[model samples]
Target: MLKIYRNTSIFIFLVIIGVQWGFYKNYTSEFPNFIGKTNIIHIHGALLMSWLVLLIVQPLLIKTGRTQLHRTIGKVSYVLGPLIIIFLFLIGKGSYWRAIGKVPEHDILRDMVLDSRGLISFAIFWALAMLYRKDAASHMRYMIATGILAIGPGVGRGLINSFGLGIGTALTVTDLIALAIVGFLLGYDIYKKKNYKPFLVVFIVFLIGAFLWQVRDSDTWQSFAKSYASMFY
Candidate 1:
């Protein structure tokens, strides 16, 4: 079981690297314009780069079984993890709002309250991860949650560039792709391993439900936005 976990961690780390590389290559072209538009863009970009580097290096530390070093860094990671997720959430909200040209029956602005399911799900998962800090299973679930949480934007950007689906279709399709990949991972694990990993199942189920709900629930999202406003104010 330890061996399987170690291997899975390594595999996920590499996959994150590939995802990062793709993200950089695909989106760096917009950095100049994006950065000029909002200071949030620059901060968000720097943090994401750091997060990606940490993701890649973290498994190396774990692979070497350097528990002390890993634990020290893990403490810092616990704080930064949610911050990164929040940054992504805000950025997504900003980007989607700016992109809506012709509002349909519903579009990014009308329904995008608090980044909807994607970001909210990430926050909850990361929160739970910290709550379960003593459990290895819980920690790993948070890592997977972070990976999938970041996946929506990564996959969305890739899809928009590669396929040129219009605005709503592009985002919706991209999110669906992210969701699909995560779903595939969980389903494959359960089918092949013949066990549903509880921690993973909880996070994934939360994500899927949030994703579907945010996309469809405009009024609820509006209420959610007001709630987010109240949090900081």
Candidate 2:
């Protein structure tokens, strides 16, 4: 079990880089000039980045035998985690408002499904991680799952902006990458005879998200998404 978590920091660091690399073309490239961006974007970026940093450092702390410090940071996440989720919803709300009348119903429906499912998945993973805090193996796996979840938005956007893939293609590729990571983890867990349920659960959640994306154009989803968006301010 300890062996499985030993490389968590390295994996999370790579994910951090992937996220930044994805966002750079459109978001970070502007750098100091963040002129037109809203407060929610800045706040969400700060909170999400902080969570990523915490995710990376927490594992390193445990690996280095700084269990006390790891616990301290874990406690901090009691506040930090919910804030990140709230900001995610706010960002989604902002997206809905901004895209209304500007994009087609299909686009709006798809975006909402992606946004809502991502939020729900992240919340589920984080909550389960918190609940399993006493179970190091489960906790660590779920924490790692959150980092995987975080990478999708930036990476998907990067694919669109940098590779010129259409939004649909970029999103599909991003979902594939996420599932690939989860699949590798699940497979390795099985090979090592470790508990594979954590990654299996994450994989199922992600698959559901991907499935929703595939069928987001359906009238049922479109109507639900419209109603979901209306729930926000």
Candidate 3:
């Protein structure tokens, strides 16, 4: 089970990197427009990549018996985690502003709500992981949940960009992927440890998020989003 966890962490990290790269490829031509500017997009990307690197390295450290170094580096997440959420909010706000007049109303609303839900889930799982850091089993489960939450936006983007899927379909695909990952982890816990509490918590939170994502462009949500976006503009 330990070996499975370590290998799965590495696999997830690689998949995240690949999916993000695919998503970015869609915007490669516009990269130069923001190259010199100090933009929220760049900050968000850097912070997220840093977190993903830490996720990959932490597991490898454990696999190789470098617990001291792993613990030392884990301290960085104390700062990194919150910064990621902050930058994510900024990115979402910036995106909303940029699209207000040009993009379709439904598209903007959907994107904003999806981004918000991902950030919320990431924060919840990260806080849980921090609270249970001393319990290696529970801590790692929470951390993996965080990773799953974080990858959702990238998965949606990859689906839209690579497969030319509609926004609704892309988001549905992303949620399904997230649900499958959580289910696999929950099954592992039940099989090996007879403990599914943490995974169950994450799964429930994710399902709620998935539900919200599916209805983000509804009239009620659009009204809420317009009210929220008015604050920044």
Candidate 4:
């Protein structure tokens, strides 16, 4: 059963990253519609897609004892990692406003940046993952956390766009699923490793909720976000 679950986890890890990266494998005869005009958006999308592809491939490479190659990619990952942070704020500022209907009452950009619990979660987990690189088990667990953290925006987008739901509620529900994902991983980590000290995970979730609360009542933030969103539209 343990082996089965591990295999299943790897398979899921592949699928989540695979379909996303595949979506932008390049405009071709078999698959097109890879159309976004903004350079920041396109570059960030391609970079992130590469990151996800690396996520899927890294484990296999390690398993086959290609540790040297893995380390070389690790160097690139260090650079791209921060770029992800930058783009998260940049693209997410736009995305959040876009999701919320460009309201006059709130600054979605501020909410996306200052109110960012998800991005912080990714930061913490990715940092820890890098820090624990010498310790494979700890590194793997943190990477899993990072993957879960990375997936929320995609999941949130899919939930609202694909399901015809209200964007606000859809995003909240999407965040909830990410919280659930962390909870499940925490439980699994405990079962597998006999350790339950997921303080980092708890910190991330609390920040997310608190950030949401902070944004809910800011007047200046609302105006700024609305105006920031307007620049593009």
Model 2 TM-score (2 dp): 0.95
Q: C-alpha displacement of 85 in model 4, angstroms?
A: 1.5
For residues 78-180, write the lDDT of model 2, one tens digit per residue. Answer: 9998998998898888888888899986787677887799789989999999999999889988999999986678788878877789888888888899999
Best by TM-score: 2
For candidate 3, which ten residues in a row score worst on lDDT?
28-37
TM-score of each: 0.70, 0.95, 0.89, 0.70
Q: Rank the candidates by TM-score, best first.
A: 2, 3, 1, 4
Per-residue lDDT of candidate 3, residues 1-233 (tens digit): 56956885777676677557555755544676744334677778788778877888888888888999999999999999999888877877777777878989877876787777877888898899999999987888888787776566677777777788987888788789889988987998799876699999999999998888878878988888788777754
lDDT for each candidate structure: 0.61, 0.86, 0.80, 0.60
Model 1 Cα lDDT, one tens digit per residue, 123-157: 67667667777776656656666665555566555
| Clash pairs detected, candidate 2 | none
Flag the better candidate by lDDT, 1 or 2: 2
lDDT score at residue 167, model 2, on the 0-100 scale: 82
What's the lDDT for candidate 2?
Answer: 0.86
